[model samples]
Target: MCKFLQHTGLHQCVPSPAGAAEGTPTTHQWMLRASNSVLMLLPAYHNERVFMLAYWILDLGSKKKKKEKKKKKKKKKKKKKKKKKKKKKKKKKKKKKKKKKKKKKKNNNNNNNNNNNNNNNKKEEEEEEEEETLLKIVPTVVCSGG
Candidate 1:
């Protein structure tokens, strides 16, 4: 559930009593993924009842479908503009980072012998510690209607 919200770029969500926030509500309470996307859920909601039909049968009504279509068009325009701005900023930042990295490489080459020895020793110790952790595990229990 956390991963699904993260994928949509939504960092925070309202807590729902029924576990997942995005799916259909069990009662009068519901938690949405984002503040504004609640419109999508309300249209499909049928007097506190969950959809019993298959995926193709559920409809949000014509009014809601039209409103959602408009909202999507506006969102697409805004998203495209934001993406262009981000791409420009990323290119400039990457160029600056490459220059800084080159300067660091030159300085490191001056003390290459000592730095290489210390780095190798540190890596070996870290790998041994990681291996120990990977070998340990905890059992998990699941209950089904019991």
Candidate 2:
């Protein structure tokens, strides 16, 4: 039992099967692997030099999973933000187009008003010219006393 415990920690060692109480070294290793798989417990090393192996087993996989999930979330958020930005830009463009149309309509109205004023001024000038022509054509009659 002490030998077994030395090979596997008391907390981690599993009871040997009655059918395979005495097994070869390879068989024991296989049993340990089966036990670990059934128990869902991955082996860990408490040593310094084997730290890289332990780290590879435990740290990298979980860290990669977490990073991937975070990246997916960030990508989703970026897509949403881009969509919102596009909507806002479309709204701004529509507003700008409306403003430009309104300005054009106002300009057209002002141009019409200016044209009407010009027409009125031209009619007044024509009336003045006619009056001058009539005055020039009319002769003053004078009576002389002898």
For TM-score, the strongest prediction is 2
Each prediction's RMSD to truth: 33.3, 15.0
Best by lDDT: 2
Please give, for residues 1-146, the per-residue lDDT of candidate 1 as tens digits.
Answer: 33333443443333345565553332222222242343344454553322332121333345578899999999999999999999999999999999999999988887897889899999999999988887785447687796
Instruction: Judge candidate 1 against the unseen true structure and give its global Cα lDDT, from 0 to 1.
Output: 0.58
Looking at model 1, the pairs that clash are none
What is candidate 2's local distance difference test score? 0.63
Cα error of candidate 2 at position 76, Å: 1.1
lDDT of each: 0.58, 0.63
Error of 1 at 17 (Å): 33
Tens-digit lDDT track for model 2 on 1-146?
A: 23433455532444554565443233344333444342332344344433343344455557888999999999999999999999999998999999999999999999999999999999999999999999899788786985
Residue range with the least summed lDDT across 10 consecutive positions in model 1: 49-58
